[model samples]
Target: MSGHSKWHNIQAKKGKIDAKRGKIFTKLGKEIAVAVKTGGANPDGNSKLRDCIAKAKAANMPMDTITKAIKKGSGDMEGVTYEEIMYEGYGPAGVAMLVNVLTDNRNRSASDVRCLFDRNGGNLGANGCVSWMFQRKGQIVIQRQDGMDEDELMMKVLELGAEDFAAEEEVFVITTSQEDFSSVREALEKENFEFESAELTMIPDNTVSLSMEDAERVQKLVDKIEDNDDVQNVWHNAEFPEDFEE
Candidate 1:
C-alpha cells in the first residue's frame, strides 16, 4: 500500500469525524441501498448487506435510517436510484488511483470528480487506466501484539481460504477472494480470531514509490477525491513504510 493509503487507514483510527458526518452518512446510505438492491435485505441470505449493515452500525447510524434506506433500495419505498461508478486516475509521482462512487447523477459527479483531480495535481483517466493495477478483494486487519506469530496466523487463515496474509508492524492483513470473503470471515469468527477490521477492499498488485514531497502531493489528491460527497471509496497504488511519519 502507498503512504497515502496507510494515512487513510490511520485516519480511520482517529475517532469520529462529525464535521464530515453528513457526507459519511450519505456514503453509508448508498452502500446500504446497493446491498439491499443487489442481495435483498436479510443479512442471513445476503452477506454483502450484512457487512454493510455492520459498518453502518459501527458508524453509529440510526436503526430507523438504515431500515429506511434498505426499504428504498428494495423498492418497497420510493427513492432516487443510485448508480455505482468508478473513476481511474494517476496522481503526482504517477500513483494509480481508483475511486468508487454512488451517484444519482453521473454527469454531475463525473464533472465534479474530474475537477477535483485537476485541482489536486492529478488527472482523471480513461476507464482502464489505473484499474488494471488493482483487484477487488476481501481484506481484514487484526491488531498486532507482542507475541502474535505471523506464520501461525497465516496458516490458520490460509487454511480457511484466505489468499494471502501479511504482517506489517502491528497489523495482520489478510486477503481473500470476493466470493470467499464472508465464508473466510465466518470461519475466523468461529475460531474466535479477533479482527480490528473486516471489509471488502481493492488491493493493489503493484506500488509506485515517490519522494516524500511527491507523496504528500499525492496524498492531497487522494484527500480531495475522498472529500467529494459522491465518492464512496478510493484505492491507490502507492507504497511507503508503515512507520513513515507524515
Candidate 2:
C-alpha cells in the first residue's frame, strides 16, 4: 500500500480546468495525434494511442474530433514533427517537479517553460536532478460507488497484474508496473470497469510537506506551467490542502 492518493490533486485540477474545455480538447488532440504518429493508428495494438483516446473521451471530447486527430497523426500533417521532452525542476519549499512537453518548436517551448518556472518561484533544473525522485507507473482511479466490493476488486486487480491498491475516502487507487499497465487496463475494460482516471504517470518516491503558503505557491506554479500549450503533464511531490481552487 503506497498510502498516497493524488486523486485530490487530480480533482482539484479538473475543477479548475472546466472552463478551459476548448483548450483542453485541443491539447488532447495533439496528444492523440502524437500517439498515433509514434504507435500506429490502431489503439488496440498501441497502448499509448489507446491511453490518449481514453483521456480524450474522459474530457468529453467528441468522437469525430478524436478520429480527426488520429488521422492528423496518420500523415495528413506532413512536414510537421513533434518531439517529446521532459523538464525537471524544483518548486516552492524544495518540492521536486517534472513537466512533460510535446512540441514542434523545442527552443520556444524550453524558453517558455523556463520563464514560467522563473515567474512562479521555481527554477528549471538539470535533466537528472529531480527525475531520480520519481518512478513511472500506471495509475488508475475508480470512483467509489454503492455495492462495490473492495476486497474482491483488489483481488481481481492483482490477478490482472496490478502492483498496489489503496482505498481512499471516495476512490480506489490501483497501480501497476510500467510493463504490466496495458494488460491490467485492458483486462479491467473487458470486465466493464469504468475508470475515473487512468494513465502512465510519474509517481513521486516521496513527498515534501509544505506550509499552506508554500503549497499555494507551488500550486500556482503548477497552474502556470500547465497552462502552456506545450506542456502535457506535470508531476510534483508536495503535500497540499484539500479542495485547492483558483
Considering every candidate listed, which one attains the maximal TM-score?
2
Q: What are the runs in model 1 whose C-alpha is more than 4 Å off?
A: 1-22, 57-77, 145-149, 241-246
Alpha-carbon lDDT, every model? 0.76, 0.86
lDDT of 2 by residue, 130-187 (tens): 9999999988888898999989999999988999999888888999988998889889
Clashes of each: 2, 0
For candidate 2, the per-residue lDDT at 94 reads 95
lDDT of 1 at 124: 92
Q: Give model 2's TM-score versus the native structure.
A: 0.95
Query: What are the candidates' C-alpha RMSDs?
Result: 3.5, 1.5
Clashing pairs in 2: none
Span of 10 residues, lowest total lDDT, candidate 1: 1-10
